[model samples]
Target: MTMHLALSALLAIVLAWAGLLNLAAPAFVRAEFEKWGYPPALRVLVGLMELCAAVLLLWPNGQRLGALIGGLVLLGVVASLLRTREWLRLEYPLVLLAAVALVALV
Candidate 1:
């Protein structure tokens, strides 16, 4: 595969695997997210949302929705990071934005 394809593949696996992990073990990840100041409900919501996004991402026609959801996720993360005064963490959102852009471009 070309580098771009490889990257997409890796991203796909990461997202898909995360979706499964979230759905299968929300409480476990929720604990980690709680340390980051997110509530259990928020963690579960994020996990469920991620699971949906992952399904959308895997669907050929659902790319648009996935990208949109991903962008929104990035925005939400950025907002939280900003509120926490963690400008250094901006890269995470930027990366997600880049992922959305890349997926759209593809």
Candidate 2:
């Protein structure tokens, strides 16, 4: 149980930091996110969603719903990441998997 909580905490931290990075450094993943011809607005929206989700994810009863949101966020990235195999691969998907796992176990 504790381990699940700990893992959730770690996942939350990762997402929170990722949100910060994306919001602060849109260029970091701009090209990758744009690969599907998505607009810059999309990238901005994803960052905002992630930032909000991270906060929601930290609260006790919010975990499950948070995971759902986080999963949506990752699913978007992973779909694209799979196509590119990513220049900065694994980190996003791995954290996403962790979020999913936390949802399952918690």
Candidate 3:
């Protein structure tokens, strides 16, 4: 249980940070989004979804739902990276997806 909580906290923190970056519309994020053929507005939407997932993960009763959402989000990211042929970028989301799945199982 302790390990599970620790992993959950870690994932939540990472996602929250990423979400903030997306919401802030940093230059790097904007460039990356453009490279991925996504509109600037999509960054805010993704950020909001990530933030909600982080919140759900932090809430004791919402862990499962959070894990599910987080996993789905990462899955989408993986798909996008694959579609764009960004092989190098797929690693992070794949790892996160695994973590999210583990958290969901726990």
Candidate 4:
């Protein structure tokens, strides 16, 4: 497969996994959201959005839109990390944002 396709697939998988975690709201997920001071319901909403983006990414003609949505979601993640001053943990989401941006562009 081409690089674009490979990257898209990878991102989709990552997003889907994350979406599942958020939807599941296990102890860590619940605690993390609580620590972030966000409303409890927001986690479910984000999860649904992430899953939608993943589905779109996997769609034959929806990669661009999926990338856009994923990028936006990652942007929010990065912003939250920065706001929370979680410097060490910020790298992963920043990398995801960059990957999503690249997917959107290419």
The best candidate by TM-score is: 4
As a whole number from 0 to 100, the lDDT of residue 87 in candidate 3 is 97
lDDT of each: 0.68, 0.73, 0.89, 0.88
Model 2 over residues 3-105: C-alpha lDDT tens digits? Answer: 6676667767877887777767566577665676778778778888787777766787887777777778888877777677665876858667666656656
lDDT score of residue 44 within candidate 3: 90
Q: Using TM-score, rank the candidates from best to worst.
A: 4, 3, 2, 1
TM of each candidate vs. truth: 0.69, 0.78, 0.93, 0.96
- Predictions ranked by lDDT, top down? 3, 4, 2, 1
Q: In angstroms, give how far residue 2 of model 4 lies from its true place.
A: 0.4
Off by over 4 Å in 2: 85-92
**Model 3 lDDT tens row, 60-87:** 8998998898887788789889998989
Error (Å) of candidate 4 at residue 14 is 0.3
Q: Model 4 scores what on Cα lDDT?
A: 0.88
Residue pairs with backbone overlap in model 1: none
Ten contiguous residues minimizing lDDT sum, candidate 3: 67-76
For candidate 4, report its TM-score. 0.96
Name the 10 consecutive residues with the lowest summed lDDT in model 1: 3-12
lDDT for position 56 in model 2: 68
Global local distance difference test of model 1: 0.68
Clashing pairs in 3: none
- Assess candidate 2 and give its lDDT: 0.73
